[model samples]
Target: MFEFCADPSTLETGPWFACYLTNGVHLLFYQSFLTVLLLLAITAPVALAFGFAGAAASRSHIAPLRWFGQVYTSMVRGVPDIVFFLFFVIALDQALEWINHQIRCPDWDEPIRQGANFTVCQAAKIPLSSSPQWVHEVYNFGVAVFTFAIVFGAFAANVLFGAMRAVPRAQLETAEAYGMTRRQSFWRVLVPQMWIYALPGLSNLWMILIKATPLLFLLGVEDIVYWARELGGSRTSQFAYPHPDWRLWYFLFLLVFYLAFTRVSEIVLARINTRLSRGQATMAGEAQRRAGA
Candidate 1:
């Protein structure tokens, strides 16, 4: 935003390009990258927690709990991710609004489902219509995060369940031999060892999660993909900085960004795998031991 940028029309090539990139809209575009990063940061751990719960439930002695967990992982994993994304966000949104409507507008109840329209009272609207623009954006982003977590969580649960099973039965038996209860053995022996087995699957899930960030656009969060399309479109002379269609260039930048991000993720996961491999019986652990020797 140089002072000379005031007259975008008269500005030369360098100044025009500089001003174009530094404008308010471009700033928003830049901020959208952080939004994507934040989504990953929040969704990963939440999804992992969900996975752990589901995995544990699946392994539970109680039939109902085990069946519930099995159904959850099987159902969510069986569905196509995009279909789940679309259906779940709308369904979850309506469910929340329906709950709010019941609570806030109990007396004034015109049927919620009017052929195709799902109507709720004004007070029951999430974030409320009168809230700031940022409130709406935050709410939408939150919904996207939740939707991502649920879908990905099921896959993560499957990975974790397998990992939990892969832990040698002898280890648990040894814990029991030492007078540990089943729960104690699970926490002290099984949980600690499952990560090494889970890491590979979890790493793959991480990469998928990275790729999946673009789906935020489908959920109405104006993420990097949304901004890229918006900013990269051809602009007419009526606009401050007219340009031909540059979506190809914008998408190329995204391609580079994802490649770089995934590369770093690979490096990090490798290091973590090495760390987890130490003193374990896996091939990776054996390699580490030999290397150390």
Candidate 2:
């Protein structure tokens, strides 16, 4: 990044460190932090949508829908996250390729599953063999997003479902007495009030999701954890910039980053909870009313 970076070996302490930090590899490391943030940004809302759908499905009048939602939440909650992460990505990828193979390779007679290997025709390959590196990375990141969403969505669904049920029965009855349809009562009366109840659970889930970003390494997204380990390992003098094993420092930075992130999240969530609590019959609202009076 600097002209003095031409010979890193010739540089003094300050310049050496500066140039080392600004190198191409270090730039990637910096970018990995953004990758983690982007994952959280994209995953949170998508997972919330999934959770809402699942929660609504569980509460549906249709027996099949309710059963499916109940089963989804129960099954996912019971399974270990690592197991689901490993299994789901492969399964979802293969399922997509398999469907694509059927559509794009109907003329081929070769079996997709021979012994243990699952193979699809070149045309049906995800991103195709000729695609750019960025396309492959994007596809992998997308798979990671969906996997995170599905797993976290189940937990969110349980939280939301409980929140929905926590809304007072009297309120719903009153809405019905006023001639509001079930759907109208739910959307207009119940949903708005449920956030105060759901906020605590969702806040904790957000923290967990933040902690789980390291799992992106397993999904091939080259996340912060991956870069930390890569850059922190000792490099010999033959490399452009030699360094001793610094993984301890690297991980310490991660620890600090997460702690700060979660601390800020707590403050933000508290404010949101306070906002949602306003004018409601909940204890927080009642306390606010007393304080104001």
Q: Estimate each model's TM-score.
A: 0.98, 0.99
lDDT per residue (tens digit) for residues 87-196 in model 2: 99889889999999999999989899999999999999987989999999999999999999999999999999999999999999999999999999999999999999
Task: Output candidate 1 Cα RMSD.
Answer: 0.8
lDDT of each: 0.94, 0.94
lDDT of 1 at 142: 90
Candidate 2 stretches with Cα past 4 Å from truth are none
lDDT of 1: 0.94
- lDDT, candidate 1, residue 34? 94
Instruction: Give one digit per residue, the lDDT tens place, for model 1 in 1-293.
Output: 78898989998888888999999999999999999999999999999999999999999999999999999999999999999998998898899999999999999848999999999999999879999999999899999988889988999999999999999999999999999999999999999999999999999999999999998889988889999999999999999889999999999999999999999999999999999999999999999889989
